[model samples]
Target: MKRIGVFICWCGSNIAGTVDIDKVAAAAGTMNGVVYVDQNKYTCSEIGQAMIKDAIKEYKLDRVVIAACSPRMHENTFRKTVESAGLNPYYLEIANIREQCSWVHKDKEAGTAKAISLIRTAVAKAAMNEALFAVEMPITRRALVIGGGIAGIQAALDIADTGFEVDLVEREPSLGGRMAQLDKTFPTLDCSACILTPKMVDVAQHEKIRLFTYAEVEKVEGYLGNFTVTIRHRARSVDLQKCTGCGECLAKCPAKVASEFEEGLVQRRAIYTPFPQAVPNKPAIDRAHCRFFTTGKCKVCQKVCPADAIDYEMEDRLLTNGYGAIVVATGFDTHKLNDYGEYAYGKHPDVLTSLEFERLLNASGPTGGKILRPSDGKAPKTVAFIQCVGSRDKAKGNSYCAKICCMYTAKHAILLSEKVPGSKAFVFYIDVRTAGKDYEEFYTRAYEECGASYIKGNVSKVFPEGEKLLVRGVDVLSGALVELLVDMVVLAVSVDARADAKELAKKLAVTVNEHKFFTEAHPKLRPVDTQTAGIFLAGVCQGPKDIPETVAQASAAAVKVAAIFSKQSLLSNPTVAEVEQKLCSGDMSCMAVCPYGAISEQVVEERRGREMVTRKIARVNVALCQGCGACTVACRPGAINLKGFTNQQILAEVDAICL
Candidate 1:
């Protein structure tokens, strides 16, 4: 029998306040194989760890049960402590009494009873624990970054500066994302393009970085330190080397389509760059709307090209590369407002989303920076801004606040006063959140100095009253009806995780949250890391965040990649899937369910009644296995098992819990 030690934690009254720690400790002492029992105020502290180390040596404890917090939070800490005491790290089991029992149960008797049961289960599992070893895998020394937005660009630059090779893939024809669409930033109100374009250029000129625009990650395989990625390069239909960006093709193209970068405020040529300051400074043919590709007749771009760079027969190509790590910074998408018909969106030409209004505020916009209503070629003297339009409303849209809305709305109100003198701005908001540094001051400047009115309410409806908009709502603060007649209405729409975020998550084998944002490994500790090893997340793809926070996370993810590349080799997780070849039926069911592609079929010769016959059996590649235990459940013969969670250990724990 294994000599198991149980250490219950008071967690500084977090657990002891609700549960009877002495009763739980006494119960642990009476459990089978629990040779020693002790309690600690904070089991994770350095002093508490020393006590565990001394007890392991004094009592000759081979296995330990810690009645504390979740293993996800402190499992590695306790494992290292146990390992330093000359014991296998896997020999330690963490029973989460605080979160599961003490925190949930207010009754002292019930909480103590649950804590005792949890400790008993841990002791039973610890007794059956076995020693496990980790294997070393070689590092590839290269990194891949998905999405060429500010986050991706910043991460690639940081990694490249660290003297490691980086490959940046972007789905759009240009490197700039939603950041490029904005006219100005909050607080400082600096030109967004002026600051963002320089970084975009640096990414293009960096020696260690290779930029691949109009491309997307098609597939991802392998594990940490060695990942194989397949990228699909969409056809640009213009020779990158020969094109001189002379704007001849853009001016000559007869076909016109709504410009995406301009938020569909104006028409652009069928073959054109997203913006004039595009990183590549080149134009791409939109085959869906191109006259030559659709009708198969007009090759006007080819005839008008000064460098003869237009290519009519370009096809999409697939290329695969090896990367040590991957960073996802795909950014976010704005709410479509399909369900918000009450706001008169898509019905009135004057009613616009925040992004569409941002384009109108730009000097390069369709009306040359004039805040003109789309209904008529005239500037609006009065405009009403609605905050949290599809945000913080469970019935309408997302339940989380789009963090940048309040500050940016204030910025819009201030900009309106500066751009058009004598213009009035009205802002409707439930609550103005100015959490960042100097954010509160900037918001105050809008209403105090900029002659902008701040209304405290949600707009109930926006109806088109002839050439103007009539906004109707109640002032929640004043308990009275409020109405405004304005030339235009701007909806401060919320942001959502990219529509295709979950699709990309599946490809990388990373998990996403209920809101479709990529889930971090740990929200507090591993904010930039994804659940998958060697894969990290940055920007709004993880959640709604401002540019500064996104850039910080991108740099943090770069450091993680640098750490991986700096290491000669990494120790693979010891607890991986294993298969018993003797009981193998070669059903290949385990291989089908494995997300990591860790399981494969291998032929082995076996003796059956003195007859040597070759049979195919499932084999597990430890380097690729992440110990998810999916295959163990899928195997009908029960031959496959995860190392630390074998059938015997789990059944022993179940029997102990029932007792």
Candidate 2:
């Protein structure tokens, strides 16, 4: 015999307007084992919960069913209600009548019938529910942060400040990411390096932080609170301990290649630091272009080094470490302008991407902050800035706004007018999205005070004519064609996911959206959390965002990692799979399908005709099992089963529904 109580919610006419609640409650009372039935206007409210609690006490109910909204919305709320009433939370089951029946049905009679069936199905499942307990696991008080960009730096610094060990890994030779390439930030017009370099220095000086530049995450294993990670440290060819920050080796190297930090706007020696102010300020040999590696002829860098720090035979190293949590802030890359051939990006020397122009504006750049035309070493009197070159265009396959382009474009225009006196600046845009604090005012100042022209349209084509370039487009506002000849053209390209973003996501066992950005656990509530616990997301890797947003998210992710490290132990999910040793055949089929590698084989003793026999059987590790139920289905025999979602309970619910 079982004691059951059924409660139906009107949801303040949200459910009652479509379904007859009174009839459904009456029908529920007739169901076997249902000792009491009641209806409430808002079952999740405090008063409604009181009524259910009183009924459980009055009827001595052991099982309870709540026919309310979707279980995703209120399952945890109702679980707490049952636990406070001195009942096991597992004894409760919810029937989503609002979303599954009432909301989808038009007729009252039909909706009530469907709701009654749903309640019956839930009641059947609750009658067979079993009590389960969570398993306690130990925690590791360490964190791993991927990417050495601003977001990763912020997260690592915050975590290390809380007295926990943190490892910061970057694939590049330098710590400063894209922010280091920029001349100035938007709105405030602060020097980018003035703000970013100090933080980079802080990371180097932090005692609890371990910096691993020129390294990448090779493999990840284990789950929340305990993860084993293997890192691949790429060879730098220069001894970090012996190398000094002198410019002798770089100046003496003969081989040169396009500098990646400068967006290919200038060339750097084969053995050179990414930037002058690079953290550690040490140079690494580019083996691909190095004359020594390529031809075994030039050892100019090795001979020029005063400390003899250069090594031609350095090998890549692999180191494995353990951590409690991980924060991913891999960052983003600018869209390639090959699809926008009309912009003449690769065709004309004067047409430059926004990133290229940013380097041109840098004080340490090739032009020494003069903003000279690349084709000719002369300053441009008239400069044209184009917006949405690879963004907000369906034909180009990218419809999402790059989010920071409009503000950065405005900053470029403002700088062009101030740097070159009497310079004419023309900006062509579809819409100026200045939606940040003081951003609109800043965009307005570019035109009002700076004497820049703001046009409303997309550039159709850019053609080179002598020293100047001709930009042709139609002004959507005036319905007239417009053409402008300018000395330089800067295109605001779209921001996209990094080239290896998807591959990294697979290695981490995290989910990414259609556009390859890492997906969050929840869009609004758990913005920094990933679907995989202990792993978090930060910065533009999650989506397109500005500096302020990236910093905020980075700090939020750090707080989450700190919270995990604060705990001495974590409780594993009780609904994980369990194995019946007597029935397991040890075929190892379950091990093949398990994504978490929770299933394994072990020897067990079984009695056969009064004689003890040692046989192999499958075993389940509850700590590693995520309870996806893939192993249970793969088992040919009924040897494995999920704790709360047992086969008997599911079959009973099916029988009740069919009846």
Candidate 3:
């Protein structure tokens, strides 16, 4: 019998508050194979690990079970701890007493009983644990950054600066994301374009960084240190090499559509760039709205171009590349106001979401940097800014606070006051949160130095009376009803994960939160890393954050990618699925359900009677298999099994659990 050791963690009241650690440890000592039992205040800490190592050396424990947090949290930590004592890293099992046992059950007796059962099951499994070795794979050295947003731009720049080749992919025509649409950034009130455009230029000019604008990451395959990414480059009707970015094609084109860069405020030529400061400064023909594409008639752009750069036959091209690591900095989407009836976001021309308002403030916006009402194009004396439009509202909006709304609202108020002389800005909110440095001071400046009123309440109604908007709400502090007539209304819209965040997460094989934001491996310890190795997250794609925080997270993700590229080789997880050829009946059902194309059929030679014969069997590519155990479940003959979680070991755990 294998000599086993049991360690129970008090978890510093996290577990001990509801579970009796000493009683559990004593019961563990009486279990089969457990030769030594011990308890620790915090089993993952240095002293606690020292206690575990000392006991293992003293008792000569070959197998160990730890009653503590989830294995997802500290399995690797304890694996290292045991390996330091000359034991197989896989010769350990963790019974989740914190999240599963103590944290979920309040009754001490019931929790203690459940903890014992869990530990017993873990001990039984640990007895059957086997030594496993990792497969070393060479690193590709190049990194890939998804999205062309500020987060993606920053990450690409940082990674490229580290001397690693980086591919920055963006679906949009421009490099500047939402930041490029802004007039001025908050707190400091510096010009948004001034700060972001330089970075965009740097990314375009960097020799190590390859920019892919108007392109998307079509597919991501393989594991960490070796990912094959397929990118779809949307055709730019105007040839990039020949076009000199002159206005000839745009001026002669007889088709126009609502401009995305201007927040749909004005029409742009069919053959046009999103913005003047676009990184590539090249035009893409909007195929859907282009006159020549729709009617197959107009070739004015082709006839008028000095460089003859128009290519009506252009088609989307797909390019594939290998990357060592992938950084998902896809950014976010502004929450739609479909449910926000009270805000009247779409009903009135003067009312707009925060992003639309941001564009209105820009020098290139529809009003040309003028604080004019969208309905009449007349500058008005009063404007109302509503906060938390679709944020922190359980009934209709997102439950999480859109972290940037408050500061940006303040910024809007400041911009309004300066742009329109004597303009009064009224901001209504449920609560004010200014958590960043000098954020509170900046908020104070909006109300004190600028002519703005801060009301602590939710706006219940907005009525259009004549050319003005009447905003109605309650002042919670004074218990008084407040009504003000304003020229325009702006909703501080909530920030949400991209509509396709889940789809993207599926492609990367990463997990996402209930809100559809990408999930981090550990919120505190591994903020940038996803559960899937070599895949990292940055900016609002992970959660709501302001510019500074987004940039910071982007840099952090770059450092992580740089660290991976610095490695000579990466080791694949050893606990991958292995097929027992004897048990495999040549059924290939396992291949159909694999998200990663890791399983394939192979022909093996076997001696039947006096002659050799060849037969088919399912084989697993260890490097591509993520150890998800789907193959094991699908294997009808019970042939496919994951290391460290084989059928026999799982049965032992089940039997112990039943007892």
- TM-score winner among the candidates? 2
Residue-level lDDT of model 1, residues 1-659, one tens digit each, is 88999998899999999989998888888889989999999999999999999999999999999999988889999999999999999999999998898889999988888889999898899998999999999989889999999999999999999999999999999998988988999999999999999999999999999999999999998888999999999999999999999989999999999999998888899999999899899999999999988899999999999899999889999999999999999999998899999999999999999999999998877777778889986888999999998899898799999999998899999999998888999999999999998899999999999999888999999988877899999888889898889998999999999999899998998878988999998899999988678999989999999888899999999999999899979998889989898877999999888866678889999899989999999999898788989999999989998899998899999999999
Task: Judging by TM-score, tell me the better candidate of 1 and 2.
Answer: 2
What are the per-residue Cα lDDT tens digits for candidate 2 across 128-163? 888777889988888999999999999999999999
For model 3, residues 517-571, the per-residue Cα lDDT tens digits are 9999889999999877889998999999999999999999999999989988878
Model 2 is weakest, by summed lDDT over 10 consecutive residues, at 591-600
TM-score of 1: 0.80
User: Over 4 Å off in model 2, which ranges?
Assistant: 1-123, 577-642, 654-659
lDDT value, residue 504 of candidate 1: 95
- Model 1 residue runs over 4 Å out of place are 1-131, 581-621, 624-638, 649-659
Position 349, candidate 2: lDDT: 91
- TM-score per candidate, chains pooled: 0.80, 0.81, 0.78
lDDT by candidate, in order shown: 0.92, 0.91, 0.91
Model 2, TM vs. native: 0.81
Could you tell me how far off, in angstroms, the CA of residue 176 lies in candidate 1 after the best superposition? 1.0
